[model samples]
Target: MAFTLNVNGTDMEVDAAPETPLLWALRDHLRLTGTKFGCGIAQCGACTVDIDGVATRSCQFPVEAAEGVKITTIEGLGAEGEHVLQKVWTEMNVPQCGYCQSGMVMAAAALLKDIPEPSDADIDLYVDNICRCGTYPRVRQAIHRAAELLKA
Candidate 1:
């Protein structure tokens, strides 16, 4: 099964089953390993990727379902890691272990794109990726800082 996918502005071919999780196709077939697989179920956000501008869990999403959609993994966030959110994440030192940072950044990016100056409540509601490292405070701060950077 060869599926031609539009990922990060490029059309690439992936040989995988229709029901194969999009995470495996991205990581194994496409070699885009930035999207991590924390849990096979969608409980953890480590496998998040942007599907048509929405943060989608790649772990459960099927390859066929993602066909023809614009898929953006952490590697696609910006060219050479220059996205505003990435910059803010670095400056704020948002990650402790850095395991969940990719998903955190993707979720935050989606949230900020929708709501530029998100309130703390909005942050609490939108950014739901779990981090055992307890980096929630820094994640929130980084989102705020990214918002500020966007405004400038």
Candidate 2:
């Protein structure tokens, strides 16, 4: 079947089964490689994306469910790569191996949207994506830094 998804505010048609994971449609068909695949199951959170501004796991989500839905990947997180969170992430050195950074950033972006000034507790509750490189400390730091950047 052909699923037309509104990704990053662009409409693109992809041919895939309804059961095909949204991750595959985004990466394989749409060639949006920023969304990574860790474990096929949703536990790893490496295939995170924003569905209507909410951080969603693309690996477990079906392509059909994404039809006409607004989606955003790490590549489109910032227009022209100027997102303050990305800058904060780089300044804080949040990534070790860089494999899970995209997902972490995506989740953090959603969190910041909901809570402009997130507390440690808010981060602890919302930013639950696993980072195998153990960059939680830096991730937390970058989140706070991003919040600070927004305040300025």
Candidate 3:
């Protein structure tokens, strides 16, 4: 099936099966590789993307369901080194292997949008993405720092 997806503020056409996961469509068809494929079951959060402002697991989200929704991958977050989260992630050294950072950033972006000043508990509750390097503390710190930067 040919699906038209609004990705990163651009309308992209991809030919994929209706049940094909949006992760593959974005990476294979649209060539938006920022959204990674961690766990195909949507448990890892490595394929997180923003669909209409909500952080969604793209690995299991069907491409047919993604049509007409505004999708934002890590590539769409901002220009290189411009997004507050990106800067904070770098400044705070948020990633160890960097494999899960994109999804973590996407999840964090959604949380910050909904809660500008997130508490530790809120961070724990919201950004559920897993990092094998156990960078949760730094991720939280970077999120707080990003919030501060956004506030300034």
Candidate 4:
């Protein structure tokens, strides 16, 4: 089936099966590889993307369901790391291995949207993306820094 997905403010057409995961379509078809594939079951947030302004796991999201929804990948999150989260992530050096940074950023972005001034507990409750390099502390700091940057 051919599906038209609104990605990064642009409408692109792609051919995929009804149950094809959105992650494959974005990476294989749209050629947007910023969204990584960690765990296919959505346990890991490596394939996280912004769907309709919410952080969503793309690994399990069917391509057909993604049609007509606004999907934003890390590449679309900012123009060359201009987004607050991106800037903070870079400045704070959030990632140790960096494989999960994109997904972490997406999750953080959504958390900030919902809770502009999130507490430490809020950070723990949300932003549950796994990091194999044990960068949780840095991730939390980066999110806090990003929130401060947003205020400034």
Candidate 5:
């Protein structure tokens, strides 16, 4: 099947099976490797991306389902690598293995987009994406830092 995906403010036509996971389509078909694949299932947020500005697990999402939706991966989040979240992540040194950072950043970006100043409890509740490196505290710190940067 062929479908046109609106990703990162660009339209890309892909030829793939309807049931192909968006992760594969993005990485294999579209050659967007920034979205990592930690777990093929949705349990891991490594493959997270923004579908119409909503953080979504691309691994579980079918490529055909992404048609016409605006998908934003880590590559699209910043212009010239200046996104507040990216800057905060660098400042906070949030990643340990660096595998989950893309998804973590995407989730944090979405959270900050809605709640400019999210509390610790809010982050705990919403940012359920796991990081095996035990970087939760650093992640929280980065989120707060990004929020502050966004405010300034």
Candidate 6:
């Protein structure tokens, strides 16, 4: 099947099966590899992306389901590397192996977009993505830092 995907403010037409996961289309067809593939199942957030401004697990989301929806990957999140969350992530050193940072960043970006000043509990409850390097503390700190940066 062929579907048009609005990715990072660009319209891209890709030929793929209806059941093909959005992750594959983005990585394979669109050549957008920023969205990682940690777990094929949706349990892990490594394949997280923004669909209509909502953080979604792309691994389980069918490609056809994303048709006509605006999708944003880590590559498109920041402009000139100035996104508050990206700046904070860099300042806080949020990645260890760097495998899960994309998804973590995506989830954090969504959380901060909705709640500019999120509490620790809010982060805990909302950012459920896993980081194997035990970088949760840093991730939490980065979220707060990004929030502060946004406020400034």
Question: Against the hidden reference, what TM-scores do the models get?
Answer: 0.97, 0.96, 0.98, 0.97, 0.96, 0.97
Q: What's model 5's overall lDDT? A: 0.89
Off by over 4 Å in 4: none
Best by TM-score: 3
The global C-alpha lDDT for each of the candidates, from Candidate 1 onward, is 0.90, 0.90, 0.93, 0.92, 0.89, 0.91
lDDT string for model 1 (60-151, tens) is 99999988799998999985779999998888788899998899899899899899999999998888888989999889888888899899
- 3-56 per-residue lDDT for model 4 (tens digits): 999999999999999899999999999999999999899999999999998889
Q: What does candidate 5's lDDT look like per residue over 74-147, in tens digits?
A: 99998456898888788778889989999998998889888999999989866778799989999999999888
The best candidate in terms of lDDT:
3
lDDT of 6 by residue, 12-95 (tens): 999999999999999999999999998899978999999998899999999999997999999899746577888888877888
CA lDDT, candidate 4, residue 145: 88
Using alpha carbons, what is the TM-score of model 5?
A: 0.96
Higher-lDDT candidate among 4 and 6?
Answer: 4
Give the per-residue lDDT digits (tens) of candidate 2, residues 54-126: 9999999999999867999998998555788888887777889999888889999999999999999999888
Clashing pairs in 3: none
Clashing residue pairs in candidate 6 are none
Which tens-of-lDDT digit does each residue in 1-82 have in candidate 3?
8999999999999899999999999999988888899989999999999999999999999999999999999999975868
- Model 6 residue runs over 4 Å out of place are none
Worst 10 residues of 1 by lDDT: 72-81
